[model samples]
Structure formats: C-alpha cells, structure tokens
Target chain A: MEQIIDKYRGDSTAMIAILHDLNAAFRYLPREALEIVSDRLSVPLSYLYSAATFYRSFDLEPCGEHEIQVCLGTACHVRGSERILDALSRRLGIKPGETTADGKFTLKRVNCLGACALGPLVSIDQKHHGHLTIHQAERLLEAYKDEHD
Target chain B: MMIEVKINGKPAEVPAGTTILAAARSCGVNIPTLCHHEALEPFGACRLCLVAIDDAGRQSIVAACNYPLEHSGLVVETGTSAVWQARKMSLKLLLARCPGVKVLQDLAREWAVDTKDLLLTEDRGEECILCGRCVRVCREVIGKSAISFAFRGVERRVSAPFDQEPDACLGCTACAFVCPTGAVKVIEQNGRRLIAPWHSNLEQVACKECGRAVAPLKMLAHLRGLAGEENEQAGEGVFCSRCRRLKTAAAVTALPEVKFPGPFMIP
Candidate 1:
C-alpha cells in the first residue's frame, strides 16, 4: 500500500489510472486500497466511488471466474436481444446481475460493448461471442451451464 | 494559442478545441456529469461537469466538454466551492421530474444529489435524460436523421418523423440502446408470444374465457392477414375495449340475460 502511494507521490493527476490499475489487479477494488488511494492522492473516498460508478466499465461487486456479460444496449435491443438475453438468463437460471447459485458464472448487462456491428454480443469471461442469435446465445450458455458445475 | 495545463500541477501542452471537461479528466480530475458520453456529441444541457479556471482573463463557470481552452497560465479547480454548489443544484433540478430510474439513481448518488425530502416531479413515462446521445449517435454515427430533437427547452424529446414510428430507423435498436431508460422497444414473435426487453413486464395473453396462455398477438396478427378480416384482427388483444364490449353485447344480448349475484365461497 505504501508502495502504491509512493508510485503516485504528489502526482495527483495519475489517480484514475492508479485506481484502474488497483481494480484490475484485485478484480474488485478493495476498500483498503481505496482508503490508501484517498489518503495518498488526497481525494475523498466518496468522490472516488462516485467516479468509479459513473462509468459503465467499473465493477464494485465480486465477479465469478466465468463472467458472462450480456449486451442489453439498444441496437441489440432492436435486433432481438431480449430472446438471447432471456435464453442466457434461463440457461444460467440467474438474473442479469447475479452470479449463478454455484458461483461458477456471473451474469451482468453492460450498456454497450461497442460491438454494434455484431448485434446481441455476449462476452463469456472476456471472450466475446458476436452476432448472437437466440439459438447462438443459448448454445453458448449451454456449454457453460455444466462446465462450472 | 497553446494553453499551459499543470495537470495535477505538472504542466502539459493543451491546444484549442480542448473542452475543459476533457482536459481535467486527462489530468486525473474526475468531474461527473450525466449528459456527457464519449460516443456522442457534447450536450452541455447538464451543467454537472463544471470546472473553475483562474487565469489572467475572465474566469467563469465552464462546461468542460463544450468550453474551449485558450492560452492562459491557469489554475483549474476540479471541485471548487462554487462549482460544487451549482452542480448539486443542477442535479436536483434534473431529478425533480426524474423517471425513477436505477441508472439515474446511481448517478444521483455519485453527484451527491439529495434523495430525502426532495419532491418528486412528473415522469416522462419515457426516461430520456435528454442527453441527445441517442439523437447524435443516430444522426452522426448511424447517419440517419430519422429521429431528431423535437420541441424546445424542458419539452424537448427525441422523436420520429412525427412521434409516430421512425421512418429513418432501419428497425435498429441504436436509439433504444443509447436511451438511458428503457422506453423504445422492438417486438418480434417467437413461436406465439411477443418478446422484447424494452419493457419490464411482458404483454402476456391468457384465454379470454379459460385463462389458458394463448399468444394473442401472434394469433391476431395471423388472423389479420386473412381475406375479409384483413383488418379485422382476432385474439383477445386485437379488439378495442369498447368495441369488444359492443360486440359481446350484440353476441350475448339475444341469449337469456344470465344474471347471478355471485361470490363463490370455496368450502
């Protein structure tokens, strides 16, 4: 933690990247890391969380090893993404924001993954499945349904 | 004029077309605003992203994303006293008639907008933050001016040719995707039922008589394609409320008027 502070000593401008780095390294940013970040960079903790929550990329919750992110963004919305998302949700037996009861899969909805060309995109643990149909989205989830269990 | 920006007090070269919003964010200064999205054009409508720049010239409240930078030996306060007050009030006004949204809830919490004791205003039924992200993305990115901002001031909203259905949209969910709230929807039939994520609850159809799940939209749409009823729709969802009442009256009126004061108590 002291090293984290020393790396950004008086260089308050490197706060966003520093927080991002901490988040990447620790998965979800630990509260202690945030406290250290606040104390060292001289930013309020509330302000930091506020900043983190503003952007759609950051996550405060613990993610499962096999993370499943559905593109509930609008372009996909018009392209029959609900069926795909519903299939994914039903196959996983979980809602959009919950990890499976088994903890092997975590499902979440991102505003847009910026892959509009591939309407109804789903990323399973960072591996993006593009141009997903309800058939395709379900097939992808079907593979994961038992792998973790 | 090249502006000298001490990002966290370390000087960096910033030229013109630099909105104060982009400059501060690049320098580890985080100013949160609702209407600011990198994918769309700058909508300075939401005044939450204000930054204070103290220089030799006239200093004032500037929207970072829209305000251009000039040659000035400057001191920029990312969260100054005046900036915070103005931002908080702007947030409150925006939330006054908030559509009771979770995304807005998260943003509201971050900007420290008061939740308690603040009066709630009428909802637009559509939770369009008026960010213009949808309109800009559709026009600029999608290159379809099928939808544009209609009306002005607080009454402004993104609408189709005449707020009917989008003639310009390719049935693409671009606007729906960019919408901060789930208002616009694209519906399609899967087997017999209607499925779309634009609404929280799905329009389900049960038998008007037996209460059995009878995919009404599909049944009606299919029946509507028939010869004489080319317009006469079938299924429970097709008939207008009053039309159905009149038709039911005409059908059952000739029969014995069955009247029973009924509360069936299961024993």
Candidate 2:
C-alpha cells in the first residue's frame, strides 16, 4: 500500500490510478486498505468510496480466483447473451454478480467489450471467448474446473 | 467589467463571468431553481433551471444556474416555450422519483405537469432529489466530506462510507441546514445529536457557564481546531450563543466610557 501511494507520489489526482493498482494487487478493494490510502493521500474516505462505487471496475468484495464476464451490450443482447448468462448462472448455481461457493469463479455482466462483431461474447480471466454457445461455454468452464482439481 | 445581455428581450448589464441565473435575477427576472444556493458553487444537478439561449442566432438550451454569461449581446429567453417544456419534463421525472415530496408536487401543479400518463415503478417514498447541496456544503464550506453520493444510476444515494455510521461526521448539522428538500434530518435526544440519513450519533457539548446542551462535542472540537486552538481542554470557557451574547453585553456595561474628539461619521 505504501509502495502504491509512493508510486503516485502521493498526488491526490492519482486517486483512480492508486485504486486501480490496489484492486489489481488484492483483486478487490479492502476496507482497511482504502482507509490507509485515504489517510496517506489526505483524501476523504467517503470520496474514495464514492469513486470506488461509481466505477464498475472496482470491486468492494473479494473476487473469485477466476472471473467470467459476459457482455450484455446491445449487439450481444440481441444475439441471446441473456440466455447464455442464465444458463451459466444455473450451472454455476450463482447469479451474475455472485462468486461461486468454492471461490473458484466470479460471474459478471459487462455492458460492452467493444467487440460487437463477436456477439454473445464472454471473457474468462480476461481471455476473450467470443461467438460462444452455451455448450461451449460449459466446456470452457469444465476445463478451468479440471485444471483447479 | 460589465457585459450587456438581453433577458426575455429586457436589456440587462451584468459583470463578466456571471451566471445566467444571477444575471436574470439582477434584471428582475425570476428563474425557478431548487439546487441553487448563493453560498455554494453552482451545481447544475437539478435540471429545473433550464433556459433558452440565442447567441448570434445560434440557439441552445442550458441550465441557467451554471451557464456563465461570457459574451455580450447574448439573448436569453427565460420563459420560452422550449424552456417551459424542458422544465415541465424535468419536474415530471422528479415527481415520478419522489412522489411523496410536497415541494415537487407543488412545482408540478404550478407548471401544469400531468404525471397521469407517466408510468412509475414502485414508490420508494424517498425525498432526496439528489441535488447534492448537502454534499457540496460539507465538502466545500465545512471542509469535512463525511458523506457522499454512492452507487450509480437509479440506485444512487448520499451515504456515509460503507453505509456505516460516518466516522468523520462532526454532527454539525450543516448538511441538514443546507438541504433544500429537508432530506437530511438532525434529531437531538438525550443530550446526543443524531444526524439522520447517515445515522451519526454525537454527544452534545454543554455550555461551561450554564450547563445547557450546546453544539455537538466533535463539532466544537472541529471549530476550535479551525480557529487554530489546541484540543487539550475541550470544554474550557465554552459558552452557548445565548450565554455568549449575555456575557458580551455585561462586559460592555462594565467597561469605562471614553469620549472621542472627532465625530465618527463616515464620508
């Protein structure tokens, strides 16, 4: 945390960058970590929390080891992305914003990935698996599960 | 330097960089506003102050509260049909959000806005218009940003960090005082000040002379710190407003009077 604050030279304007680094390191923002950042930067904790909540990228809760982001953008939705999301939710036994009980996978729905041509897109651990079918997505999840086991 | 601008075809000269709302008010033109406060910075959050502007035949609608009068000969129409339509739409949306608020209802009736055709989801019975006055006053004026707007979209609201009791709140009630919609409430009970919407409970500091409950202890400490005083003795010589006034009057009566040579008349 001190390194991250020092990296930004303790500049208040680098709040977003510092938060991003913290998120990357911890996979989510811990409440105590945010307090330390606020104290070190002399920025208000409420302000930092406001920014963290406003942006979708920052997760307040601990994320699962594997992240699965399904695009719910206009083009993707038109191509039956919601159906894919529902299928995954049932298979994983967790909703879009929830992490699995074993903390293996966290499912999220993103607005866009800027890749409209690949409608019904899904990204697993930042690796894009576009033009996916429900069966293929299940198989992909199975691969990660096998690797973990 | 002053710049000339015509508001609703009435010529008015206002200083440079003045907001259109201020310029209109200076010329006796009234622009209805809910989120505007003279003490705070212009936060164009509420869209109720929209007005039509025609600068050299280029026309556009802008919020009068924050839109500055940068150029001369800018024609501002406060009561144009477009302006009324915009304001009515804004009110209609606000009514849908806060159906129980009387101020929004009155504004809707005055503007003749019919929300009959407007379909609303569940009535949340919420009064906060998200005007951000309390947030701005706490951050800008009081210099303590104990509360802030959290979340986004329809789920957005003013809250303390993590929706927990605010750690930094002074219980100053400045947020409650500045809230236009009376959304923030300060309740005093059992010698404690409870700032609602954040649920911060602070012990009230008593006046040293009379032992009456004064301001909140944390708020007094904050003020004393602002005054560049050490906080070791938090309760020493502190007096409430009434006690302080009486003390000043008594001290004035006890002072010896001295005659001045010249008449103290201002030129």
| Candidate that scores best on DockQ | 2
What tens-digit string does per-residue lDDT give for candidate 1 at B108-189? 7876777675554666554566777766776677665545565444555555533344323444456666766654564544
Predicted complex 1: CAPRI docking category:
incorrect
Which consecutive 10 residues in model 1 chain A have the weakest lDDT in total?
Answer: A44-53
Off by over 4 Å in 1: A1-149, B7-10, B120-126, B183-267
lDDT of 2 by residue, B1-267 (tens): 889999999899889999999999987899999999999999998889999999999999999999999879899999989899999998878877888888988888788887786555457778999999999999999888999999899889999999988888989888989887888888888888998799899999888888888988788788788899887666567898999999999999999988797888887
Q: What is the DockQ score, from 0 to 1, of model 2?
A: 0.85
State the weakest 10-residue window (summed lDDT) of model 2 chain A: A133-142
Q: Model 2 residue A109 lDDT? A: 88
User: Cα lDDT of all candidates, in order?
Assistant: 0.66, 0.90
